[model samples]
Target: MILATCVAPLAAFACRFNVRDVGFVDLGSDPYRLYLYVGDSMPMAERESLQSISTATFYDSNVKPQLLPLAQARQSEARAFIPEDFTGGVPAAVLVSPDRKTTLSLPLAKSGVSVLQTAWEALEPIVDSPRRNAILEQVFDSYGVVMIVEGKDVAANTKVRSMVDAAVSETTSKLPGLEKEIQQPPVVAVISTEEMEAERAFLWSLGIREVKEAPRVAILYARGRMIGPVLDGERLNRESISAILDTIGLNCECGLDRKWMQGVMVPLKWDRDRKQQVAKQLGFNPESPEIRIEMSQILAKSGAGQGIHRSKIIGDTLDELLTGYRTKGLAPENPPKQNKKPFAESLEMNKPEASELMLSWVVVAGILILIAGGAIVLFARRRES
Candidate 1:
């Protein structure tokens, strides 16, 4: 694996995708929120600072920036979650979760926009470990990464590592047929238990606090979303690996629920050059307004994408555990559309009875067997005669 050498740090998957890409497409991910609270009367210095910082974070990275009236912030649904004692003034900044359940409020009144800028910098902090750096470097171009988090037991770690290696090999051999344009096949990266401690922030981003089990496999794809649950013990196997890879390789339009595709992602630095390079390769901008609307429409039809609800976000740790700094398990809300169908009919289509389908298959098998038997009999008779 190649390592990233002195690359400028920036948020990688910020606004790109909140979902997985088994194939080469980045369907789209939810962007983080940055709300600036201002009033009818404000100083020009604070105003200038807010504009400069918000503009930079919005265009240059994955975080979304919004300017809200101070009065609006007071009435906003997210205000309830803000720390009551923090007492950030009207010219404040609220860093909100995609789900809007958790918020970190900074007093822009005193610190200016520097406080918010500092918080944004924390989103994509530099990593010290070489193994993780390599992952950050290559994950952008690959189908996904099969990360084998090593544990204290050498034997257990070795065993899981070998299984993951075999899975990666098998998956790679068949990659060309799956997504021919994929620049690289699925990669296998290992995280030593020691390295785990060193990069706890990175591990935390993956919802991994500790290595409860020595060897675990995390299936990562679509800009670091860890699809499905983390696997260990009986759950980690060849079948599970194939199931995930097959799902990723499934056509983006296969009608599978996007919920299964969305996973928690690690926050990595994604600079402009890399983002543009990927966009050019993808043949379209995943973050473009048109693409976002299309994804919203897809999610809306499935009743999963109508934006996050304030009621769902309860606690910080719990939300983090469930969403991995992303939104998940969204309630089904039907967004109004033209010529909508009845809910029941929209969910499924009519099909032939099971008995009829079985009979058809049985009849085809019988015909094929008869043809083979007749040819065998003819060949034998000719030879004997």
Candidate 2:
């Protein structure tokens, strides 16, 4: 029994294949699998090809070269492969193994097309020939395959449909070579919509209009005059409202308001402490008219109505107090410090320079000279004898 167990272990080891043992074939000329290596300094064609894919596509660093060996070992693995062609000016490298495993590495190239093309070329030999029937059969065993699409704006572009279709056609066409190994076409997964919009907005804000689709999220607010839902003239759901607030570093709480039944109006400013206080004071409906009159009276008595208009004083003080309460719950326990500098100190700081004082005296002397000359001329005329 022990010898049998040892033999079984040996058999499993023999069946396993290393990625290095696989061979790569250049099918770059193939119309369906046209491959290109895009680098930071690659050609334009490769970049364009990559752009043809969806704007939502993104590269997965963890799975890039790791999946190449599996692709070469079985034809079914082709379903997991994606074709990328680089057209940028950046340089890149494509490596493949004899067992059909392929590795496409882009050191500095950001183009997704270059990476895909490199991978396609590396596995072209096994995918194109009939001698690799066993591998193809294995690829066909599954109903759906995983394909990676990489690009910066991959999620926003509508062109991804064509790229996906092309990849599916090319991969499925070779299924006949390994009929028993192949199962189904591959499924394409792109970047999430939220991520796409975020990227778009960021790029646009930075003056990058050429960027991909802009993400959009619905915004909704409570139904009231103070706060309601409206985004570019559209209404939003409760969930959307919450999401919008969250994005802008705000929050909302839902509850009944006895003071102002007009449906909880979110103050212009968010005040957690004030909100709680108001919530507790249910049924205590403070009249707006009364509040206004009280505020007017306070202003009239304070003698702060000289150059500072009465209305301005009332508005500023009320707003300050109300906003403070809403945002930070009541005033501080300790009063604020008043400016108490002595008049002498103030005069010393405000004293004019000697040059400025001399200039002022000269202007005064010129005005006096003109006045005296006019008086003298009038007296002479009167004594014209």
- Alpha-carbon lDDT, every model: 0.56, 0.29
- Lowest lDDT sum, 10 consecutive residues, model 2, at 17-26
Q: Taking the tens digit of each residue's C-alpha lDDT, what string does model 2 give over 332-351?
A: 12233554789889788768
**Candidate 2: what lDDT?**
0.29
TM-score, predicted candidate 2 vs. hidden true structure: 0.16
Count of clashing residue pairs in every prediction? 5, 52
The TM-score of predicted model 1 comes to: 0.53
Residue-level lDDT of model 1, residues 1-385, one tens digit each, is 0112111112221123223433223456565566776664656676676677666655644466676655566687645544454344545566655455545554444344444456345333322246666776656667778888887899988888788778777667655544224557778888888787556656655556687656887777765566666777777776566555544543333334555555544544456786687777666676577776655655444321212221222222322323422332222113335547776775554354465467657656666777789899999999999
Off by over 4 Å in 1: 1-28, 34-59, 64-75, 83-97, 100-133, 179-183, 197-201, 211-213, 262-265, 268-271, 283-385
**Candidate 1 lDDT for residue 287:** 56
Number of the predicted model whose lDDT against the real structure is largest: 1
The deviation in Å at residue 218 for candidate 2 is: 23
The all-Cα superposition gives candidate 2 an RMSD in Å to the true structure of: 33.7
